[model samples]
Target: MKLRETLEAQEFEPYIHITRGPGDGGHWARQYAHRFDLVLISGGDGTICEVINGLSGTDKPIAIFPSGTENLFAREMGVLPDCDQLIQTLKWGRRVVMDMGQVNHRKFLLLSGVGFDAHVLLELNKFRTGNITHLTYFWPIWRTLWEYRFPPMTVEADGEIIVENARGLMFVSNISRYAVGLRICEQARYDDGLLDICFYHCTHQFRLVKHAWNTVMRTHCRDSMVTYRQAKKIRVTSTEPIPFETDGDPVGNLPAEFSVIPQAVRVILPP
Candidate 1:
């Protein structure tokens, strides 16, 4: 059945807004949120991130209807692509409040990456012309691995320094799992009022490979080189131009401060 038909069956008046370009989803969502009781995002992770940013500072409940984009947040929220499930969720789903992470001035609902993965996303965004599939990541990851030099950075969580001038990838995540199902921040909890930070102390290609293997095996927490912590606020800085990404999109270079907005976003989930 069509979305409009399904919504009408549930006594909802559907309002469809097709995003014209980047940031349009957030712009429109912010502009019109006062008029709607709930907002449904029918796109992938990027689109969902945009809409979530738009809906910040409001009590509006948002629902994720997975489209062609990688719905990593949806995965964490137990949202699926089934039409009947989506429609039923539109009406009778449980309302759960999830934490939102803010880095610099931008808000992210799922995960954020600093260093290596951000470098990979930066390269991917450079050549990204259209919708990308999982296969589209091959060239970017390979190119970034060879080209990216491990930039040194320091991390301060809740005003205490955890890793000082570390060289590797740092993940500040609201969700546990990452790309290819790697539980990069396995201790993350969306409603926990804190952000989980995981750092893989990688200095060479061999160590990077080893860290990846450990992350896949869910044994990185046991490795001494891997650092894991959770806090309400985090400050990451680098004198060098180190990049960072939030919710799979490359945002900007660090000297960024991250903080958690607990019980911020109200999302509908399968009951």
Candidate 2:
């Protein structure tokens, strides 16, 4: 509401949109983006993901309000929560063109997970009621941690076999930072026309926990069980369809092929 007042005070008549359910943000954005100069989004990572999908392949730049839990992309772009900062960003912000990742046909601007983390979201949605916070994930994480099986999978990067029949977690990211500031893809550059994929080879629950700790310490790359690579295209296949989370939503199961779209979107960034 304060954001609305601020825009109104500045003599801008912005159309207000409130999403009613899943994919509404993207639906509205894709349908009405042609009429707008700048698309401003208010919500969390999931909402931002939807908006990005709607505006994919267009020149319409976006500014975020960063109201959601773990607003990872907003933090990566240096967007803040204050209305004053938002006003400054609007008036004198840096304009950046960023790369986006595509899984199948859907687009993502942050990171995608293809293993246990994605499994957590799949379980969370089974009982998700409404808006979620960091705490909302605790139960789901705990449950998925116990139930998840380290499925065997094969990964190909630019048509080269990087991982063959590996059992662990796979992360593909456009940015370095993830939830809780972990640099899962530490060398990722949003404009570099490549996606950074990290595979943590684990066979048991204890190994999974160790991998998580090493990742948080930013030392996972040096671990023998970890594989990190940057590629223009990445493909992962499993004996069974495994669920993958894009941005923060558990969209569907995978046999996913991920490709990077260079300079695919224009974004307003804090200076």
Q: How does candidate 2 score on lDDT? A: 0.89
Model 1 regions lying over 4 Å from their true place: none
lDDT of 2 by residue, 92-173 (tens): 8899999999999888989899988899988888989978877888999999888888898999999999999989888999
lDDT of 1 by residue, 88-189 (tens): 787689999999999997889898999998889888888898889998899999998888888889999999999999888899999997988888999899
Off by over 4 Å in 2: none
